[model samples]
Target: MSSEVGTEALTRRGLMLVLSSPSGAGKTTISRALLKEEDNLVMSVSATTRPRRPGEEDGKDYFFVEPVDFNLMINRDELLEHAKVFNHYYGTPRAPVETALSEGRDILFDIDWQGTQQLAQKAGDDLVSIFILPPSTAALEKRLKTRAQDSAEVIAQRMSKASEEISHWREYDYVVVNEDVDHCLAEVKAILKAERLRTRRRAGLIDFVNRLREGY
Candidate 1:
């Protein structure tokens, strides 16, 4: 088993990993940790019409564009998926994602359920979707307040929307309840590893098996 595993050439088509969660459920935290630890995995830089934040770099954190330009991209069918949130448009550009997949470099999308649905419609076989759930409603509310980044009114608004966000949980390929950050990260990592090893993803395996049967 060890020898066979070691000798097999690993050649796989990259996957689109979509992680969705309510506002405070730790999807961002898990995404950051995964990118840090996994060499071939990178975050999917989205294009948006929203103004860039103070520290965000163009084409890195996000591609900030005008609303008119965003509409043009949609018209051209250049985006894999797009949605409007808080009156701003955000989308995953198609070209970059296709290039990365051909090179076997996995892209992680930190998007909501609506975006995930669009991606599924466009790239069903290549996508692996996960929905993260909080351990409890009280815990979720506590997390939102603990962040201290939002005003009380905004936090209340998020709490109200969280249930609606979580209602799409049935659409995901996997679901993780984030009771502990480290544990949740580990579970997601495990899922990535297992998915990477799937027979269909590993394209080189067919040739390796053929060679073995021919006694070469």
Candidate 2:
């Protein structure tokens, strides 16, 4: 006889959404859009030994630290995943990510395949990995050139490395061919929505269902 509809209470465990692609691909653009639109998600800030560039703020862009400190963190097992890239060490701190997951706040990671592999190994169930690919090889080249930030030699280096990056496409949970930015964004968003709905991710669902059946 109750007119009101019953709503079950549930709490979802946060997921680590990883978006990786070759340099010229549109993962960065897609990541920016996702962060802007997704309210419950935050970018996973990484600590790096690389020098802070102009307009880069410590703890904002990256937690810039000395090489010695980075090594110390590695030795202490404080980093969830760490890698040496171009002679600079980059890593994600474990404490903050654990806190976020406990609070049910999703974290977005923009990292390479190696870092993704490390995270997958550490937190397989909590992670959703997506790999973005350009529409074509020529398109990838065009995008790198259009940026005009890197020199020709650098562009060539990136192009050469892209093949190896793309080869890891099979490793991801989802693959988006980034021919259209809007379409790709929508696809990734859809994947996130579906992943969030997974029964394993939503805690208290079983209890809520039992309460409903008992007329509570």
Candidate 3:
């Protein structure tokens, strides 16, 4: 045998599967489910200027960097995309993503609309963005409250920001209403299955088809 390879059985370029949603919209939940069930899919670890929380590793949770270092990365164009949020900076490094694509291993990005837009501009064809929307406004608020991870003030802030986030739904390649987690996850998986078949992503597809034609 040559070597142990990725779970993908085909010779194809990997894609960036970006799932964006407002707080408590089930995007994170669906992303976890997808990673658990799907083969050859890996999470995209981002670099941030924010301080790491308890139990979060340096490289695992995020590549924690100083603001100056993050600025250097931006200046060097080492980052595929960078954005400032809530007085902190976050960005995706370009090198690992390119390597993963060449190796035919898909990457899952749990990002926001800002990052998704930058990724689209940087690597349009490689990106498949999906925006998750809640069933209704009231339902979204209820979910936020049920999670109980934030204070009343923070929940209110998220709810307010959610309206803005939801407005960018039209920018995504696909949109899924996340009323039901299982059903929504199924739809997202279906989308991934179909996107994997895109002609451009199949690296040797043209030559393979030609070879088949010659044999016939």
Candidate 4:
């Protein structure tokens, strides 16, 4: 068993993990924690027409672009998925994702329900989407208020949108309740580990196993 396990570890592919949540959920925090803990994971930077937020650096938080340029990308079929939220356009570009896949690097997406739908259409087999939910509506609202980043009116609006977003939880392959950040991060990490070991992702495994059986 030990020798077989060692051989299996030598043949595995990386994961394409998508983590999504509503406005005040802890998806971003969990994603960042997972990235910090795992060397093989890379955040898939998204392109958007929205202005950069305070403390956000270009190409780090998002790839900010003009509306016209964003539309050009849409027309060229260059985006894997895109959507308009609060009058701003956000999208996942196709090139970088493919590059990461080819390089055997795990790509993480911090997107919304609509973007996840588009990603499923574009990378159905390779994608493993997980939706994170706050433990309760009260807890979610509390989180929003605690952040203090948005006004009361805005927080109310987000809470409303969160209801609609939560409706799409069943669309994801995995669902996680984020009551604790550390525990949720561990759940996501376990999912990524399992996804990486999936047989479909290890396309060369059969040939390798055959070689092993042949005593070469």
Candidate 5:
């Protein structure tokens, strides 16, 4: 009698996680912290019509495109999700994200609530969303001013928008109160770990379980 041993293989699958927050809510800081700590995670590069910031790379920080190209992409249905922020259009391209997921790589998204809603419609199963909130509106305003990057007028506008942004917190799958960066990072780590172990993420779990039952 010939018998074959059932080989157990570890396969990776992709995840689409979004981290959204109002200005000065620490979403970008948390995202950087996550990337530094999580070796296997990558940030999704969004395409934008805005000019590149100093020291920002073309593809790393964002896929900088002209207004014409961005409008063309919208017409072609190439964006998975997109939004207009401060009069500039920004969007996540469909092709790169699809390719990354198919190849078993996890992608991180830093977008607003509008984009998150659109993303969920397109990638419901693979999507996990987290929204960050400042300890208080006053604290949020303080943080935004600490950076001193924007003019007083612009800061006022952002402060106004913050209220609207925070109103959508219930729409996210997870809501994180970023009172302390270290503590919040720990919370995010736990969230990711738990989500990674979800049954749906294990595409081969059923077959693997069957093999064990059969003693193969």
Candidate 6:
């Protein structure tokens, strides 16, 4: 039993794990933590038409492109999911993602609910989406204020928009209230482990079972 236990890992197809949440709900914090701890899990860098900011790298931070090139990629079906935000287009390129999936390397998407929906339409079988929620509106507001990056007006605006974002919680496969960052991260990690073990994602599962049935 000791020798056979955890001897071999199964060959599995990868999944697209999406994390979405309202502002100040701790999704970004959770995402950073996951990337730090999870093996074979990497962030999905998006191609963007937005101008590169200072200290941002090309292809590393974002695949910065011109508006025309971005349109061309969309027309050519080179993007798995794409969306316009603040007059700029951002998209996940199809090629690298497909390659990663086939090689059983998971991709993490820190996208909004709308982008998650777009990914669902194109890759539902490979997608696992989670929505993070704050324990209460008051707590969420408190978090936004604590950040100190926003003025009173901006914080108020973010709170208003958070209401709309929170309404889409039902569309996610899993929802976790981020009252505590450590607890919330653990919940998400559990979800990931279960999803990775799913039969459909295990590429050689059928062969492995058949060998056992043959008494090998």
| Residues 98-196, model 6: lDDT tens digits | 999998989999988889888999887999999999999999999899989788899989998999889999999999999899999999999999999
Task: Write down the RMSD of candidate 3 (Cα, Å).
Answer: 3.8
Candidate 5 regions exceeding 4 Å error are 1-8, 51-55, 149-152
- lDDT of candidate model 3 versus the reference: 0.90
Where model 3 places Cα greater than 4 Å from the true spot, the runs are: 1-9, 149-151
- Write the residue-wise lDDT of candidate 3 on 1-216 in tens digits: 133333333689999999999998888889989999999899999999999999999878899999999999999999988888889999999998999998888999988888888899998799999999999988899889988878989998999899999999999999999989999999999999999999889865666565556665
Instruction: State each model's CA lDDT, in order.
Output: 0.90, 0.89, 0.90, 0.86, 0.87, 0.90
Candidate 4, residues 49-143, lDDT tens digits: the string is 99888999888888999999999999999999999888999898888888778667889888888888988999978899999989988889988
lDDT by residue (1-216, candidate 1, tens digit) is: 222634446777899999999998988889999999999999999999999989999999899999999999999999999988889999999999999988788999988888999999998788999899999998999889999888989998989888899999999999999999999999999999988888888886777776666764
Better of 3 and 6 by lDDT: 6
Which residue pairs does candidate 1 place in steric collision? none
Candidate 5: lDDT of 199? 82
When summed lDDT is taken over every stretch of 10 residues in candidate 4, the lowest stretch is: 1-10
On a 0 to 100 scale, what is the lDDT of residue 156 in model 5? 93
Which digits, one per residue and each the tens of the lDDT, describe model 2 over residues 62-178?
999999999999999889899988899999988889899877889999988889999999887999999998999999999999988889899989898998899899999999999
- lDDT at 140, model 3: 91
Off by over 4 Å in 2: 1-8
78 in model 3: Cα distance from truth in Å?
Answer: 1.3
Instruction: Look at candidate 3 and tell me the lDDT of residue 30.
Output: 95
Clashes of each: 0, 0, 0, 0, 0, 0
Pairs clashing within candidate 6: none
Candidate 1: list runs displaced more than 4 Å.
1-8, 149-151
Score candidate 3 by TM-score against the native: 0.90
